[model samples]
Target: MTQEEATRLIGGIYDSIFDTITKAAPGGKPLMAPATTVLSLAKPSIAITPKDFRNPWTPGNPTAAGIQPALNTAALVDDAIKLSGLYTQSGVGISEVYGQVMDSVHIKTQAPNPANDKQLDDAFNVLNRKVEQTDPETGEKTTKTVESTLLTDYNTNMIAYNMAQAVYTAAYLEAQKTQTGRATWPMLAPNYQVPVKIAYDKWRSNFADKVEQAQSIMQTSSQNALSKAFKYAKDVFESYGVTLENVDKAMSRKIYRSTLLPSDWYSLT
Candidate 1:
């Protein structure tokens, strides 16, 4: 989902919870609600669990469907993705940027299955390096990298390693800045762990036992939804290159535009 949409959804949820509590209170005297980390709620886990072969968000809900591997070299992936975005936004070929990143990193290795973890790590070592070259005659040296190039490009905006993170950051920032979230998401100047400690305390002292009764229903549903979304994203993104689907373009065209039903429905009658 677009960051704005997720922000709205999360905001609505927070509002609903507050409203329900307010109405249920004895005399409308609002209970002092404790501010909690709003990070986890930025994009709550999906409550609709997808089945084995039944993709819940196949061609639909493209914004909500996306995947990125949990990896050690995620930074490398981000570097490439951001560079690609810089190129894409400026009307340049994404492939050109990818090639540049690969070359500078000294990535001479190739993997048959680029999606594999081992293979990605191999390429990561290369892509994660600084660009360098040495003059043959004069022994002069120079270095260049995508980040350096990006810094010089005037057209660069919304830098991101990949589309999914780009979208997530927008949503995350919205939640962090929202009125309700500011108190909850801030860093404690003196103690960084204050919020974390409070969260842990709250979970143990009040929330955990209360969640048991609804676990099956909430847990099952969310897991299913997440599964489908994750699969759809992986299907549309390749570890080594540009996204398989351009979400905006794909969502724009009419699904049945090519159908024999024809443009004029009255003609069938």
Candidate 2:
């Protein structure tokens, strides 16, 4: 048979088998697209011209114009027939086939803590500290003493939190396959439960490290903001000749009316 004919024969057989299995499955439908492998006949051609009997001494040099058996069909048939079995298995919706495809793709889901408010708080704390720093040599102070409202924007922090949650969730799901007393599924027989658990544990540890890193950043920012606020308060107190007690009194009064001022303020001076 020609190579093209062999390819068609094998492909048709595999497709038939695949359809049968898909129909038998619980859903009675194929989960994926049908796959096909095609083999083309090798057509080796040689051109002959009226060059005369220039090389009459050459062996098999027929001085005639006719078609030659230039294609090899046997090898093509052998290979195509052998590969048909693989195609049939793939079409049957085997776990190995689907697992390979799933492994290559990532699915996103909602995080347990979608807001990541804690992580945001930590990040803000860290950034605030840096913003409040005063260069000892330059004697230059930060323009803003406190963190801006912009720092509390939750979008960036939520994304980081979600990424960490994804890693954790993936690890957890992988670990659940080996839970005690669970019936072993035929598809997962190749892998031991212990090894999968170990891998997932490692994944969880890495995710924790990422969360800590994020929290550390926020802590530093918060410290910076506190430092800036403290410095600003100290400078104001020194300029006004006001004692800490007077400052507290001023803050406690709801209105600046003289009647609302503390009675002991002048005695302290």
Candidate 3:
């Protein structure tokens, strides 16, 4: 996306997570909670378990209605998601910015050029030019030229490529600031890890095991729900890019939205 779009995305991500946590926690205590806090309340003891989804073929089971709530609970304790909040507030990390740059490069390479398509070329040539319009209800065959508002796949793709290029530029600038020393490729610079190691460490040491168990339980629940002819949960899961249809392609991308600034690059320096 463009620098402006990227900025907006980062702000939106921050606001979404922070605001949601604020509303969920009493007096917004979670927002001020230390990154090291284990958040034990998110542990699997209270979450949906594999036992809850047993017997997929059983009649009158709650498997179909429970997938979403289980997934939501799993997300609450996800390390990557927790780091996303810190990532937004800390101006993101070096690896995250580079990941976005890689995505932009890939998008730019895949975008179809207008020159490759004759019809699209012709359409773009007269994109802003006048086009004839007809008034069908007036029973008048009078033709008047009006500005062409036609948008084609080529135009849409080029716009996406331009926005991606803008993001690439922003990422490059971010890399220049985050890089520790000279490197052949600035975008591929070192220290590609998250900025706050303590947060990750705390989560791993105290919460990873329980969270993983909870996620496993939720995954089992999702699979059972999908297999039990739960179309609603299947459709909802697919909307989030998760599908039992292709287990290999469940999570296509990992980099999330967050701004970049050297001053906010804590611990990584």
Candidate 4:
């Protein structure tokens, strides 16, 4: 299932189960009641035994599984629920008694599969590095961090990479169109005769700018790798007495469009 659906399903299941348990308890208040204070005065209790709650095959498995996992999944959820009076009788709200619970759950819930882990990991790595940069005007640090494992999944990573490729391809194509049929001078010869030297210089400057912008979209490592490959190509072209400028002109003339889909990256052998 999609990540949003999975999150909502898990969240809904937990809320439903919590509602039922609270209603059946002797002095338990409705789970949705707003508290006068953030901290609850009464301790809460679990209606079901821990073992039954943890088991996968039990009839109460879905509800129990939801609650048990949530206890350790997030601090806000666990802290609020555990500190309430739901678990006790003196002042029943919800469980206010605190205790350690299992931090992970193993159930049959359908969610994004484990195969997408590598994709999620790579995406986070890129985002982490990107976040460390300082904003130029404000000098304030800006970051966008997401903790979901599904973010690194094949689907998401592919989306990011494809976006980068599309931007790169568009810029490169525009550069190529502008550079078409441009004459090249062998050197800065004193006797060089060109009709419009200033125009040539302007075109060259714009081409450089576009290339730089395209390269900037990539992460540092990816940019470095591509630069290294291009350098190798440059050296080979130089062996034929081709200048670096001429080589860049030739390479930019070729348009490269990626045809690979995201699913192709994750296809099993």
**Candidate 3, run of 10 with poorest lDDT:** 254-263
Q: lDDT per model, in order?
A: 0.39, 0.42, 0.41, 0.39
From the highest lDDT down, the ranking of the candidates is 2, 3, 4, 1
Minimum summed lDDT over a 10-residue window in model 4 is located at 94-103
Error of 1 at 38 (Å): 50
Error of 1 at 141 (Å): 75
* lDDT (10s digit) by residue, model 1, range 84-202: 21122234334445445444443234435434544444333333346788999989999754433222221122122234344445555765776775665454322434444554454
Two-way lDDT contest, 2 vs 4, winner: 2
Error of 4 at 221 (Å): 37
Task: Report clashes for each candidate as comma-separated counts.
Answer: 13, 18, 0, 18
The C-alpha stretches of model 2 lying farther than 4 A from their native spots are 1-11, 20-31, 34-131, 143-269
lDDT at residue 154 of model 4 (Cα atoms): 32
Sort all candidates by TM-score, best to worst.
Answer: 2, 3, 1, 4
Assess candidate 4 and give its lDDT: 0.39
- Candidate 4 residue-wise lDDT, 62-134, digit = tens: 3534443323222212233444433323332112232111112223434563554444445445433332558
Score candidate 2 by lDDT.
0.42
**Model 2 C-alpha lDDT per residue in residues 155-200, reported as the tens digit of each score:** 3454555565566556556656785423434344334445545554
For residue 73, model 1's alpha carbon misses the true position, in angstroms, by 21
